[model samples]
Target: MDFSLSDEQRAIQDMAAKFAEREIAPHVAAYDREERFPLEIYAKMGPLGLTGGVIPEKFGGTGMDHVTYALVIMELARHCPALAGAASWASGVAGVSVLRFGSEELKQKYLVPLAQGKVPAAIALTEPHTGSDVASMRTRVIRTDEGYILRGNKIWVSMIKSCGWMIAFGTLDPALGRKGVCAFVVEPQWPGVTTVPFKNKVGFRPMETGEVAFDDVHVPASHLIGQEGEGFRVAMCSVENGRLGVAARSCGMLRGCLEEALDYIPSRQTFGEPIGNRQLIQSKITDMVVWHETARLLTLKLASLKDQGHRARQEASMAKMYASDVLMRGAEHAMQIHGAYACSDDFAVGRFWRDAKFMQVIEGTNEIHRWLIAEFALGYRR
Candidate 1:
């Protein structure tokens, strides 16, 4: 019945808020304009323990709980969702898999550096031909005496060049379907591993997304995470946790939309009076407020459920689906309230609007999430 953030969680939230204001807010516009990743920001974050919020102290992390981790992401995304997205990708989504299933040697090699933010990491699960269809991935990993040879192409991996390692999934035999897949922590600089940047993205521009191709990339047996044939489970674990992260980011965007509208309305004059005086303008502001609070609660609920060691697949889907839809709709309403000003780059509303749409597609598409929720409700899926 406790709905309030614990004292420790509040402290972490405040710290992240301060970090966002001082580090993220000022440079966000320039970074987005140039489509540049803020490497220096993450460097600063590493020293502040922001990079290791979910990592255990033994692994050089803060050992923070998932709820507190969600709070930190909320603050970071409030200023810049792209920055938050990149940070979550490195610290939580990619690092969590290694912590949960990687061997000690693999953790020392990859997880430790990731916890310290000495380098970045990414998960490569999306292929050019396969997105939602995990069983149909064309990427293949063949057995080799040395270890395994990875040969495949991964598209839309965020910050590919910047990451030191990739937690990639490939199938041993496509015929075996999901059971045949395996997860490997492959070094990005290995021979035959090449990447090409994707430019002109509609949103999330501050993060450098790219396509990576592995032509007989060599991976040692030590690099494998979890047991063989466990890649599907490993990827799903990361993804399930990742749903909460995306929800947190969506909550932040929703809050940002509300704050922007509130700030803009009073200063904007129409018909010899401030727009805030108009009932129609007030309605938009009220809607933004509602979405912000609703999404925030759903995100925290999902995080709390996760912290309790409960099965949260259905809850995570609901949170991600509802929050993403709220963000997209909230952004549009905020844009409409801004009138013609929203179209200009001089304001952040346009950027927020574009990023909100992208949020709906990442982590998992809203369509997939809808199906998942429907299945759960109908007792057709566990």
Candidate 2:
């Protein structure tokens, strides 16, 4: 089988890689340490033509393919997973949804600014009561003369503070189940909308996850994406895109672990020679290489399927599960190689370890994905 990136993909990968090393690498650690979002950097990416890679040129984007987008995400994530997460949430999840289902007016209003990095958008799915079980959400949206009135609380909403608009989900009637849900383009600055920061996060500190509360927030009719009662489908579509993004980020984390381990092994001397000479250290490093390569390939496969207009729901789950699992493994191995030093902020492995665990939890937990994969294999699901 041929395994070569297209010229466009290679160019994006190279540009992203160099940009990460030169721009992201120097400031990411400081952002993480300060637990502050790298708000300005995202806007700066617009001039580099990196902000609108997901949508078409008509929507103020370059119309880059999914595989190329994945490559760029991986490169950004190698140094700053939080920054990569923000970019993916803005471009892949929320931005793509607008491109797919939004009206021309909505596209001109929100998507164009988002593509230009003048405005950030967020996908509001997770709630305090409902995590992955989105159908059971208690947030209610009622039809009114002016428009829809939204009253709900969304927790663990990433980039909330930085986002000007939110692609939010709410249920009109709980008895209708998923059919009762609808997606709305919510203005965060509207009256009765409030946000609270999630303090002291374990990882992804620079991404700024928060809780958003909507109390009688009026949403105009023009902001509704797709038809009423189609919120579940819209949310799932965004989620599929997000799953691939997470997989790419996991691949980046694995690469970082390998690179960090390689740099440390030779310089760290044990007994009479370098620790790299030992069989155990060599074995861990070898496994890390295998994990990184395998995860990267799986991520690319998912991206390719997406570019081909395939649904990719099942394959995205598999890629996300396997890649995230590999990331956790690589982080653990890096920690073992670094020994005591891994516990301190002096090394990057500690952050990777925490972030890898977070990866498994988000974009649907690994356990949930495993069950879904099993169903797909058993011919019970498609």
Candidate 3:
């Protein structure tokens, strides 16, 4: 039960930390203010292998292990979760599906460019009406002599315009339920594909999240990921990676809250004395430390399980659920400690608070995870 990071892992962690402080920290406020994706920052990340840590070297990625990948995400997220998320979308969430299920031609076309950070990618499973209920998705795909014709709408798709391609899931037949699900690689520039950006998001404003409408878009046969009727499996397999990424980001957010609160506490004065002298303030700081450590450990445990090739569905849910909850609560407490200043955009704690709420909603809602954790414990699911 060795818990310490290996020398290589430590080096990678340090490198990511330096990159975040040097590259992302300076631009976070401006990007968030403008609600713009930092394409230039991502360009730098591609050359540093930050954009493709999970991908294989053969695909032009750094071929790092999952633990190292988690560490990188954690470091990047400490400064900007949006940047960490964009990196994960390209490397783990979107790229892993193609790496595992995509054909050789698909890999050569998408993964090569994705690993190089030349283009980002997106996964479109959530629809206008369906989120967790994937089987109930209204998107439909019809088989044609040329390929597949897709007609459906996907919402909350991040990096819509910037992604070179996206893996979209749709049902072949409405009556077939999950068995009818099919996944396809759809290029955003196709004739029938249209995207509408979601504006005024509470958090992750720097990310380009939007709705994508595929109106009878033609997809080449070679673009299909895995076999027909296998889209459900493809979507399910990617959850672990998605959950792990969210958990790692939550840990980083928790750390950010702790650091922000710690920095402000002593300097803040109350009753002509430092707020850090108050026991209540100290207690909140203590809770932040505990939450950060707990989240990090759970996230790392899940990452280790993945690297060992173990089935960690339950663990992934647990880590994602707990870490996100901690992030939400920690951000709240940090805000509370900051008092009126927390509400202002001048402080990072407010940003953390806004972003923390989204973590609980994305990956899987905390409510859904609670149900899953209990079901796994009761032997209702395996």
Candidate 4:
């Protein structure tokens, strides 16, 4: 299959790269240190229609294909992964749920404003009780004449501290496994909704992750996305698509680490000789390159499948798993090449190190992804 970018793809990538260089790379250092969400950066992205890249024209989006979206993600991620994280959160919260699944009214009410970047959005799925067992979520939504009352807590929802809406998933009936789960669009200012911001992450600090508590939060029936007993499927679908975005991001991080390590090794001195001249450093760099290409190759393969209207579950998992590992190991090598300088923000490698570790945790932990890959290969059907 041809992996070369079309003219349109190149244009989008150029635009994303320009935005990242001017808007993200300069301010990322201070933002990362402060652990703050970059609203100005999001505002710049909104004008590019970045917030609506994959939604249809009717849904107020550019309606671009998935591969183009993935390219934009990669270009932006290369400059600053935190900015990429914010864009990723906004894209999924606005496009996938409403443009793909929500009713007309839900799209108008939430997705429209979200696409314009007047407000941001996030997905709240993981709870204190639920990890990879999405069907076992303990959050409950009790029906009412008006709508539903939500009672549960979601953990590690990123960038919602300033978002205007949350696409939340919960169970109408827990005993029903996947079938009982349902999805809803809940506004941030809803009467019983409360959020406590989390700070001091090892990496990706600019994304602003946190906890969301739905203490008898009341939502209207009209806000239900798709229908009752359909939440789990929608959540899984959103996450599956979302993983492609993560793969794009991980590749960007891996490439950054690899480039940094390569650039440093040749210039670094060891015993009056270039350390990169040594065989050991060459071997480490070679290993990093291998993993990085593996990540990129898997990402492109899954992206091709997605464009062909095929399921890309296994491909996405493999890309995420390998790309994250590459980023982590490459970051380690980057730090080693720079020695103690990598520990400081003085070098980009330190931030990449922390951010790469954070990537390993988000999207789905490597542990979870491994289980999925193993299960698929073993022909285990759930």
**What's the CA error at residue 367 for candidate 3, in Å?**
1.1
Q: Per-residue lDDT tens digits of candidate 4, residues 206-316? A: 776789999999898988888799887677666656787788888888788888787777667979999888888888789888888888888878777887887778888
TM-score of 1: 0.97
Clashing pairs in 1: none
Which candidate's TM-score is highest?
Answer: 3
Task: List RMSD in Å for every model shown.
Answer: 1.2, 1.3, 1.0, 1.7
Higher-scoring candidate on lDDT, 2 or 4: 2
Instruction: TM-score each candidate.
Output: 0.97, 0.97, 0.98, 0.95
- Choose 1 or 3, whichever is better by lDDT: 3
Instruction: State the local distance difference test value for candidate 3.
Output: 0.89
For model 3, which pairs clash? none
True lDDT of residue 265, candidate 3: 86
lDDT, candidates in the order shown: 0.86, 0.86, 0.89, 0.80
Q: Mind giving the per-residue lDDT tens digits that candidate 2 earns over 306-360?
A: 8888988888998999999999999999999998999989788998898899899
Better of 1 and 3 by TM-score: 3
Candidate 1 Cα errors over 4 Å, as ranges: none
A best-first ranking of the candidates according to their TM-score comes to 3, 1, 2, 4
Give the Å error, residue 195, model 3: 0.3
